[model samples]
Target: MTDARVMRDRQASVASAARRLDDASGQHSGAALVQTKAVGAYPAAASAYYACTPLRIDGPETEGAAVTFTGDPSRIIMALNLGSRIPPVGTRLIIHSSGGRWAFRYDG
Candidate 1:
């Protein structure tokens, strides 16, 4: 009986660990500097961008960079990494991973 109890505990621990790993793995991480053009709305619009080249992706920064950091900036849009989040600083394109399954906060 003791052996069975021990085995059950170990299995539970393993399952918990696996769940954590799975959740962590899916979490995106990274940021980049990308140029963008005014498409559709001014800023309320999301995922409505293209051509995220001349990018300078790096470590963690914001939700924007996290979802788009797949080691490749291609097939993603990046926000301007300068000035204000507005036109004065130029609208920045939030970078995302493939298929645009990511999201970002409201820009300023």
Candidate 2:
């Protein structure tokens, strides 16, 4: 009986730990900001092919380098890191990731 109780407790602890980890992972995965830019009148299918290049966002006392797309500066978008979801359309941001440049759109 005592052994069975101990096993049950251990299983419960493990499940709790797993739930905590899952919550943390979800929180870490999401869009952080939006950016915007304008581009030539190309088909919507070509929007996802925009090339991203490294650039710096200047500040008064600090400068941060980030990846930016080359194109019209009027379209809005957002920036996200790896594992983060892409922001919805109309929202603009410049995302930075270790992986190569790519674009994402929210399905829902």
- The most accurate candidate by lDDT is 1
Candidate 2 lDDT over residue span 1-108, tens digit each? 699999999899877654433211144223223343323442244234332222233335535545543333433332222333433334444443222222444332
Query: How many pairs of residues collide in model 2?
Result: 24
Q: Candidates' TM-scores?
A: 0.25, 0.25
Candidate 1, residue 78: how far the Cα is off, in Å: 7.6
* Positional deviation of residue 76's Cα in model 1 after best superposition, in angstroms: 4.8
Model 1 global lDDT (CA atoms, 0 to 1) = 0.41
State the lDDT at 88 in candidate 2: 37
Model 1 regions more than 4 Å off:
1-29, 39-54, 57-89, 93-100
Query: After superposing candidate 2, which stretches have Cα over 4 Å from the reference?
Result: 1-32, 50-89, 93-98
Candidate 1 lDDT over residue span 4-106, tens digit each:
9999998998776544332112453443344444444445334333333333445677665554332332333444233323432233445433323232333
Q: lDDT, candidate 2, residue 91?
A: 42
